[model samples]
Target: MLLLLLLQQLLLLLRLLLLMLLLLMLLLLLLLLLLQLLILLQQLLILLLLLLLPLLLILLLLVLQLLQLLQQLLLLLLLLSLLLLLMLLLLLLLLLLQLLLLQQLIILLLLLLMLLLLMLLLLLLLLQLLLLLLQLLILLLLLLLPLLLILLLLLLLLLLLLQLLLLLQQQLLPQLLVVLVLLLHCYCFYYYS
Candidate 1:
């Protein structure tokens, strides 16, 4: 009766040990799955960066083109202003030469009005340039938004991975210790018997 009871107890201990081993294996499998998920996330991040690279380059090119166009427009405006100033000086000379001629005065007035119109057109061009600059700023913001979102996602994943690792450590260490103690107890029991 004593031997039978001892044998039953030993069997129970063996079953407990097997259950602990199975639990450990399940935990390890879960860790593997988490690691795989982390790897997949990293790969996805790399792919996203790769996809964004071309778009970033295109945006940079567009911004460069816009800047170049703005510079050209500014040069044109400067040339136009210089031409208007030269025309004004020439008209003043003509006015002095034909002070008694009404036709000459009338033509000078028309030329002055045209210069004002040109100035207004320059202002409109400047406004258009401002609008283009605003559009470029908006495009830059749009581009940065996705990058920010991706960074946030990566940070979240890292935090989750850390938490998982900490939880695994907390849960696994004590369980491993228990398993080792049980194994030692079984070994001692067998030796003593």
Candidate 2:
């Protein structure tokens, strides 16, 4: 009985260890997911930086063209042309900035779509891991079934042996006594001769 109790405790401990391993695997998967998210965020930031380079170059060219045009203007038309040029430059800057914003929006939309796709892929991988865990659990159970059956058979055999001993005490004791008496008589007869 004590041995059986100890065996049950050992089985419980093994189950707890398996559960801990499962928890660790889940935590590792979460860490992997977080790392993937960080990587995606970094990629989108890089794409945004790359997209901004052309807009910066366009601004620099516009500034240089304005400087060259200013040097060619006369003092008489300077005041009038200065106001017109300022207005035109402001309008052009606003238009260019709007276009840049639109392009950024389109890039952001693309990034969002890519993020969605990545998330879907991650979800599929997680599902696959879960399925593998379930399969492992089923296999472990299958392996344990024969061991359980064997233990049950051993317990039944032990019970049968105990019952057989009880039967001997109750029904075979008198026959055993008669055999011992016969053996004792033969030994005495041989000793006398």
Candidate 3:
């Protein structure tokens, strides 16, 4: 009887060991599944970043281009303002000359009217440029090409007007040569700048 009871107890212990081993194997499998899930998540995150990186770079480049355009526009504004001031000075000088020269009153009056028209045109051009710049800020890449063409055309018109003024000045008086030359220099500087 004693030997039989000892054999039964050993059998129970072996069965318990088997149950524990099965539990351990199940736990290991759970741990492996968790590790695989973590690895997959990490890979997905890397892929997302890779996909977004180029778009982010493109946005950054666009912002930099906008900044450069704004700077150029500001410079153009400054030049236009300077030109306006110079025109005002020339108008004042012409007025003084008109007062002193009674014999050439008719010619001086015509020149004065032309200069006034030119000043008004310049004012209109400045306003148009400002409007175009505002549009550029809003429209960005879509309007960029057309804005450039418009600016070029405006500059050409300005050059033509300047040439006309120079011709008039040459016909009117040699004394105005110095002022017209200065004006030409300013226009050249603005063009190069």
C-alpha local distance difference test of each model? 0.70, 0.59, 0.64
* Model 1 per-residue lDDT tens digits across residues 137-156: 76677667667766766776
Leading candidate by lDDT: 1
Off by over 4 Å in 3: 98-193
Write down the TM-score for model 3: 0.55
Clash pairs, model 2 backbone: none
TM-score per prediction, in order, is: 0.52, 0.36, 0.55
Candidate 3: C-alpha lDDT = 0.64
**Which tens-of-lDDT digit does each residue in 1-193 have in candidate 3?**
9999998898777756655564555556556556655665576567556645655665666677678667867867786787678778767777777777755866567677767867886887778688767757665764454556456656755665676566446643443354455456545554553
Candidate 1 vs 3: which has more lDDT:
1
Task: Quote the positional error of residue 98 for candidate 3 in Å.
Answer: 4.5
Which ten residues in a row are the worst by lDDT in model 3?
171-180
Report the candidate with higher TM-score, 1 versus 3: 3
What value does the lDDT take at residue 151 in candidate 2? 72
Residue 185 Cα positional deviation in candidate 1, in Å, after optimal superposition: 25
- Using TM-score as the measure, the top candidate is 3
lDDT of 1: 0.70
